[model samples]
Target chain A: MHEHQEPTPETFSTPVLSTTTATATAVAAEAAVPGAMLATPANESTTAQSLSTASQEPRQGEPTAQSNEIQLTDEQILTQMQAIKDEEANAHPLVDNSVDLTELEKEYENGSQAFKNKIKNLSDTHDRMRRSRGDGNCFYRAIAFAWFERVMLAKTKPELYTHAIKAMEESKDLLLAAEFEPLAFEDFYAVTLETLESVPTSTPEALLTAFQTDEISNSIVMHFRLVASAYLKTHQEDYAPFLEFGQTMDEYCSMHVEAMGRESEEMMLIALTKAMHIGIEVAYLSGNQSADEVNFLPFSPDTEPYMPPLVLLYRPGHYDILYRKSHCLEGVV
Target chain B: MAKPMFARRLSKELKDLAMNPPAGVDIIDANDFKVWKLGLAGAPGTLYEGEKFQLEFNFGPNYPLESPQVLFVGDNVPIHPHIYSNGHICLDVLYNHWSPVQTVASICLSLQSMLSSCTSKERPPDNANYIKTARANPKHTAWAFHDDTV
Candidate 1:
């Protein structure tokens, strides 16, 4: 048994992050097919940054590698990729440095009974899951559900609800098996928004517009407009200019900003919460989407023209097959 | 003070757990914010039965963003091929598939369910040699765990 489980002081927490482990883990990664470089911090950082900027800019000059057809078998690339990720992990801090749970604890302590009680429960649940070694379990699912309920419940503010709903719907479409191309976005947006307007309150009708997009249902283009309008309203402080415009629904959805008032790590949490809401709505809407459509990308700010409408395509058998193949590559499960 | 949004989200998880504790879970260590020990009752319809298991969790500075590393502890550590003698569990959601959306109770319940669902009681095929090698060169020797059945 090793006496010291922690890394040495020289390496500290940040430096000893396994650069090589990223490669090793990339090899170990389930969805990550071969030909993709091991997930180094540098690689992820650059990729994540590009993804952020790309979200802003239109899909104009960037080379859409028509060679997306290049295929590297999972097995052949696993070893080299894992080695690379492992190396990357060894060198860079894989996690953000700005989290201070202690402060959160203090805040909870000083807050309202409902607030403190609510927070303490979450903390306690988190603690229990950790101790139980229940990493991949229902504890995660339950938490996800709770987060979803809370956000939806807090939908008293219309704009927040609208933004949250639209974002959630888009995520649902992406994670579900059936594909809705960018061409479908405008139609989806228009009809969905008109239906949302018809709903006097936050009702199931609003939910219906998200997944069921037929004639008796609503036009997809109208759907996008209503949802985008709600989003613009909810985030008025950040998106005031866009709200003023009679801009196209695509133009409205295209505007991206650095998630305000939070560190990058926290931003991930917000994104995750948002993703859960998307999943919940999908489930309620009887849409085929899964929770994976939540944008799990890291944060980086940039100035660029907005990209064309992008859609998430959900693949049902992908995750399990990917998990199995990933284990095979690492020669470990 | 305006509560940080993440904290509010975390709070929501706690409320749900208290209202609905999964079938066989007990929080052993409640005071320490970072260290948690959970007790899982043997799940029904699986290999783990009438046996109690312990799991330990260590949260990082970035609590929600970074998932806690979990280790199975105590004598009941399953002798399955996938599980090592030491309680370190190798599951993806704990690391890579981890999203801040998941809460502690959900994770434990999932583990409990997985434990109950186990059909085989054997360690991974290479367990013996890996254990032997790990005894001396713990850091360098990585266990090549390979088994889908268990």
Candidate 2:
């Protein structure tokens, strides 16, 4: 019943941004993992003067305990921190196999009673859930992985795979109709189509490997981002009203959808689903809901959805793949 | 894997820049995909008209996905409210607002417009301090883009 539904923002992408959620995320990230993150731009109002002055503040409390770390420039430190965050997320593959729901329960162990109750209730029907990395693109990555997995299992239901390919193929036209240059977007489109075509013949391990690589995984993310942006741009009448005041749909899509590390919002989900003719069921696991109940929100395409909606577990600013009890594709996974 | 993407994208951009180059943009060097140098002409009717500025574009493997490291290069950097003496630009699109859809041509055009709209001939107020303390790479600088009506 609480009104706030936006995802909790995560680590700063590069330079620290001015958004309140981003600032909170940066502070939490610095505290959670100690390193050069200590030197991050503390706020959006940091003038060029403060940057130089901050450097002279005598960086203390950062003696490298793990290794004989030599000196590193602030740029190098930021780069290393980025690598560490990547490694932590890479601890799980771009997509991971069904983990016992207890594993998720462990994350909130000292955290929340309401979340604990929902997880306890969730395990009854959803015995196992797969996960995607917590990188900002997790929502798009999860939806892509989940839909592709379903299409792979639909060997008997050839229509699903065929439909997915059609949707992907038509998305290029959407980008073009929205006036996105072919030269700018063609590479992402080609990589995405190649990955989708490989899913059917590829084993689950092979699929996981493909998604693990940066080129393939990020290209898919980029393509979907473009598709969502294109969908919003071409169908402005339907979505323009939803944008914030003084912000045009083009600006919203540019900032939120096209940028790689930017998080996706509800409008993005609706646009992506409607654009690709896919349905999505997002299980909102929140502390605000009744202790024992999880809310499922549906995002459906304008027409009849061709396949069962791909399900995702949403836990504030992050998305991970979830498996229903009846799903029988363990061998593939 | 990303190298090929950079090659194809950069090559196409080079071809576009060569064939139908935007007004006042000219390529000085682009033999390789990694680094390119292009000349940006300050637009007519601006403070820098008839003045030529050299721009250096360093492309990482992440090229269109990640933005290129672009700055004023060579001897003559433009004197403007957003341009620092060390060549770092305080433009938002170059950093926080980067989108893959933007091209090298588009960037040059944006810079051209940025220069064309200049109302005064001056450097950023922080130019002296910034050039003294900033790193070689502009991306490393935590730029605050607050002013737009320069």
Candidate 3:
């Protein structure tokens, strides 16, 4: 018999869509059946279901494409339910103590239209809860990509699938920077599958090209893959799942390491050339030096003509090849 | 030149702070470049009245672009449910809502205001068990910040 009142000013800005849906689903599910899925589902299950439902519903006032590409994987959906069940059993504390949820469930079932109103009233309160938990536009994007991944995988649309992958590649920085890591994986998986769909069936070149341009993140990734590939070649028996999630980062790291190894002698010559060229104080060199630091000197066009010693060093065979190639790939550096 | 870029910007920010420090706040560590510590006074007419709290601010190489890891220091930790015993705040702005514009002063002020307006001196009901055991990992534990009846 608590009277309805507007939420306080402090909590007006919390992200509510996921909270409302999650709460409504929980209450609705409870109203429909009590003690359901009680065999100890994991915490990830609730987040997955919340994420899946988010994918289905369009944002208010904005019409989302009926993207069949996005659907929650069976594993993801199950994870959501299990997580909710765990939360209910283990973390029994709720912010509102006025009406007990267990009591409210019975009250809601027994012709309490007021209960529905209560649900609606508390919607705003939960919205802030969601926002505070790091749900935002990025979260929505993850859900959307998750949906896209499921639907496209289900139907096999190469174009939309590839587009989705590219979308993920573009949005990776956004996904990575988020505090919520679980959703990031789902989004990343969707994009990877989508990007895989876009690759032409016959050519690894097409795959390499896609990785080079639109999927430059994949370049860093490819470096990791190259490293892993090399590792596998050397230590095939001891393969680890750590780098199995995706090849992009592993590949990128491996390639950079390989490149530095190959260019070390040239790098030293370049550092010597730069010291002679610019005459810029080569102040003590106190810290741990990296290959990229020395690599910068000989290849830098601005510093090249200034040093006659550098020009002489650069006039050689490998140095000439390295300089020409470096200049060509100037933007990348 | 790269050193000057950071040095100049930091100096400018320091000068700006000297001219107009946030209300009842003090910026310390003008000499050391690594550690930036600021002091906060609890806001009046609230639970945290007349208390002085200090916050430690650490800046990484990516200044402004990356948010500072701010933590409440010393004994007067605000007894909020969301705050960790180790003084790590669970506020979204300190991590996710963190904009580049928010200075050490502004963050200290926000925390001060958040403390001053508190009607309850208790932690969230789940805080005792959750905070006790949840120290294992902050990232994995999903804190339900949804208390409406407060």
- Using Cα atoms, each model's DockQ against the true complex is 0.01, 0.39, 0.01
**What ranking of all candidate models by TM-score puts the best one first?**
2, 1, 3
TM-score, every prediction: 0.35, 0.82, 0.31
- Candidate 1 chain A: 10-residue stretch with minimal lDDT: A313-322
Error of 3 at B25 (Å): 0.9
Candidate 2 vs 3: which has more TM-score: 2
Model 2 C-alpha lDDT per residue in residues A1-333, reported as the tens digit of each score: 011111111112223222233323422332211112112222211221111111111111212132223435645654665665455554556667768888878766665587688888888767677877655677888988887778877777777788889998899899999999898999889988998898778887777777787778888889999999999998889888777788888788877789776667777888889999988887866555444777777888998888877888865555788777655544322
lDDT of 1 by residue, A1-333 (tens): 111111111111122222222222322323321121112122233222221210111111223222333333433333444454355434322111222223334533533354344334434322211000011111122222222223333444345445545654654454232222232233333344444444445444343323222231213322322332333334446544423356442233332211111111122222333332332111110012232222222222232211111111111111000011222233221
Candidate 3 lDDT score relative to the true structure: 0.36
Model 2 residue B111 CA deviation in Å:
0.5
Which stretches of candidate 1 lie above 4 Å from their native place? A1-333, B1-11, B128-149
Candidate that scores best on DockQ:
2
> Which residue runs does candidate 3 get wrong by more than 4 Å?
A1-333, B4-9, B130-150
**Candidate topping TM-score:** 2
Which candidate ranks first by lDDT, i.e. highest? 2
TM-score of chain B of each: 0.75, 0.96, 0.77
